[model samples]
Target: MKTITKYIKISALALVATFGSCSKILEEQPRSIYEPGFFETERGIMGGLTSMYAHLRWIYGQAYWYNTLLTGTDEVTYAQQADQNFLVMDLSGRALMNAENSRADAIWGICFSNINTANGIIEFAQQVDGVTEAHIGEARFFRAFDYFLLAQTFGGVPLDLGAGELTFNTSTTRSSVRNTVPEVYTKAIFPDLLHAAEHLPETGRVVGGVTKTLARLYLAKAYLTYGWWLENPNNIPTYPAADRIDPDGHDAQWYFQQAYNVAVQGIENPGPFRLQQTYYDVNLATNDRNNELLLYADHTETSEFYNGGSLTWGNGGAPDNFAGWMLTWNYTEIRSSSSSSAWSAVSSVQREAAQALGRPWVRMAPTIGALSNTFADKTNDSRYDGTFTTVYRGNWNKAGIQGPLYNANYLPVNPGDAILTFLNEEPTQAISYGAPFNSNVGAGVLPGRADFVISPSGVSRRIYPGLWKLGPYRTDSGSGLGEPNAGSTRPFTAAKFSELYLVAAEAAVKGASTRAGFTARDLVNVIRARAGVWRWDNNGNTERIEDNSAAMIASTPAEITIEYILAERSREYFGEGYRWHDLVRTQKWTQLASSYTICGPNIGDRTPIVFQRNIENFHYLRPIPLGQLDAMEGDRGIYQNPGYD
Candidate 1:
């Protein structure tokens, strides 16, 4: 880690930041705010606010940063063709995440820049005419949002970025100091969120704008996280070496109670947000930006200007929604024979901009535990179907191949038939692994089946269920594969309304006093009940109308424990970038994600091998970016997180 001076400088440079449609169905404009007195004008305030929203693109949808969020978790691990960027984060004895190589570094600069812009807006917005409390409240919300993320990932961070604490810094100062965790929560995160929740409007002016509910969601989440820090039940260490004491004179239980109260309040006053009708609808590509999504980094298929990146081709960079590509295995390698007797194979499952098949980077894969254990009751639960693309259907006709051709077991398959299917469970008969009959992507052949089938236990790092929730979608494919190479145009969901229930339940389990009708078990059952409803069978590829809510509720334990809450959270938010933070907050990362089972990266390696993670106590907090250290003045040892230096 080395030291530089402009770390404190606000990045209010002129740029085109697109704000998604708010009051109108479609709206976009460029807003440029320069540093000098920019915040004194209404336009500057507006531009700065837009940048706050735009910064999410750099963090949420960016694949490398996404790797930081889930790669080492119980959900996923590094996949075939993974570079060091993916490998280091896996924490599985491959390599450690140093400051230079860590993709968590991506958030460091972007968040600080946005925090400075937010500081500018909050400081100067009152001087501008027509700047409402709501406007300033948005700034406060973003400022706290960034700080919350930073604190969670890197322990304590600098509040005074060369300007005094929470002030707009115009001067470039090299020196920086880290704030303690409690100081960050009480001084910056909690105060800002509380103010924003009170002053912000009930609903957002724009589709993904910050609203009171969104603010309260973060507020509750922050309180919950801080409470865990204060409790330190596992005795995990914190950086900047501060004691586990709340500056507000509140104990861990008090904060947990506050978390419960705020989450309950948000649920009670959900304004325009609510749970989608079914779990499938929540992450359906077409149903994106639905009522359940509180905030998202928006992109569109209509225009590149509005979308912020090329719609037809993505370079796998920031501002491009390409996190979908990471989990996507090369389905294009799936082969179907043109002849019945001869082993003449043709690529059948070509890459397409469908919800199931997209451009595959094969950089990350879900763990076997994620499939077999986490989603154990695959038959009863609809989440496994909704969350992943378990079956790869034939679309060779779209690629100009007439498939009345023979597939696995030399079975006749037509266009729109099942090409490759990841079986829900191990079949009664032994899966045929090697032959002229099997597919190249390590999928096995089941007797009398046209599709190449891989059992849940046989899922490899190279071939497994792709994430369907964040996959690509397009209306313009027009009887052919359309824009499979493009970054996903659907908005990347960052927050959901269903989390209020989970958050409240988690707090309740942590000894927060319960309110009537909102007990810990009651809150969790609401989510479980919704998981029972099904509008579509994702694996079977058919319409399935069913209401098994009572069954789902009956399955839930009467005494809801923290473990159950964590499991349910995984079921709901799997592969959506919540696992790491959730596990870290509960001090359950090492316990839950310490060891995972996955087959080798090579094709045809279906032998599951257990891999152990080298998740040290210090590994909980990600290393501070080496670039930040290079730019700062003074002892960088004091600035970086422990064990990284």
Candidate 2:
């Protein structure tokens, strides 16, 4: 169901507060009350489940979460913002992330809070007669999901398991249950997911609910990520204590095989899932319940869509606007003199194409590596056009002019002069740019140039691709329902079923698990075909994806290696916020991103000045949040992840 009906009042338990209040009294409850009595009945169990699901909205809805994931990866960099908090060291490659980093703290807090919430629900569900395996299974799935994020992002964290490990009261002093990476995998993430997979409904459900298929998807991904750690124990600084290591053989290959098996099972199942015709279709609000989505953090504009979809305060599970929407919008927009006219630029498009023309926060921009290298197949790939924008029409309204153009300068603003014009086709050096540029294109003249060179430097006329994926799609300020600024309220995707294809392809290449009896080529080709990359297929291995590093040529399925797979993943999922984890898990962050110049004058001409970041081996994990360190009563402060202050 898109909206889970509430049957019982949600508990604001003491896990959040050291001696937090227990569930409310049943008789006094508003329609329903929260308490042990509620847990004992089916209605109460379902309501509690609804509350647990609400935790997801909290975890994924924050803007900072997206910022943490996207910045400093191989794909993105920040725009110059005088008020920006991130440093150059962060977004370039080496994220000088410290325990005090607010983003880290937010991530830690959100995950653990939800983790404890899930634990409480699971604990109560076990003793209830009416709460069947599904109720417990749902709770178990979340326990593992939150832990999986914790394990991947922070290495090891306090293993709460409803243990009051994170309680915030004064009298209830307890130590952190933080354990090692492998322990977290075995005791926390993997087992919970396994239980969830075994008990969750095998039949289809909406993206908002946990299903057997979704459980398996996460299990496979967790195993896939853990497999990387198993192979190179030394590479990760958060290695488990000597005792935590298996004495008998659990190797990377074992994890891979496990992941492969689960993935294959999910794929082979007669589930309601298949690739959508276009990448855009996967995320449109209209097709939200489509089969291709395995799981997602749910959000809705109306209460009808979700039980409390619009109830912000009383209902714990009301959907929220992602905090990162503003950040993502700012970073990915084109910098233009006429940028204020963005709305005017879109005045002619269909109403659905409500053009807000983002505020040029330019807090992040596509790395030159992302823009030029990833989409090497300029001719066939549909993703290129779908993901980015090239042409920028003028918004004469904001500019207070017919069109944005000038001869040499505005009032002859030399040196600082800028021009705004469209190029019907790319220009050769031979084309002349007449002054006071007009739409008239002379035979050998560039269409929109007005003495393009004499008045402006190349910078003035340059318009980079706006990351259209996050661009506002609706602008009906007509509703008075937070319209206009309401664009950010659009739901952001946290995961996609399409990633399963990439997972299977990568697994096949590593020989860690069954190739699903399909070659990496076949799996990748399915996505590529959907992406409109009409290249070689499983039929004959006719052509291989281009990496842009090499000349255009055909490579066979045999050439489908991890490097190509990673490159392909970049093409398919760059702005969706997977780059850092993608590179880190694949052990490619340092090799691919460390040397990137995030800010300052173009060391080689691509990077625009702002903040910068780099990657180091220790960077694989973000520092444990400082608040967590301060709260720990023991010398447990010694447990801080290395390389952070």
Global lDDT of each model? 0.87, 0.53
Cα lDDT tens digits, model 1, 1-645, are: 112125325343324233332333324454433474877777667767777787788888999989999999999999988999999999998887788998888888778877878888898889899689998998999999999999999999888877688887777666778899999999999999999999998878656888999999999999999999999999999999999877778999999999999999999999999999999999988788899999998888989977879988999997899999999988888888889998788888888999988999999999999899889877668999999998888888888986388899998888778988888887999988777785777788877888888888778888889999999999989989999999999899899999999999999999999988999999999999999998889879899999888899999999998889999999999999999999999999999999999999888888899999989999989998888888776888887888888
Among these predictions, the greatest TM-score belongs to: 1
Measured against the true structure, the TM-scores of the candidates, in listed sequence, are 0.97, 0.75
**Cα RMSD for candidates in order:** 2.0, 9.1
Error (Å) of candidate 1 at residue 150 is 0.4
C-alpha positional error of residue 626 in candidate 2 after TM-score superposition, expressed in Å: 1.3
Per-residue lDDT of candidate 2, residues 141-233 (tens digit):
877888888888878766642224322111223355567777778877887889888888875332356788888888888988888877654
lDDT score for residue 264 of model 2: 68
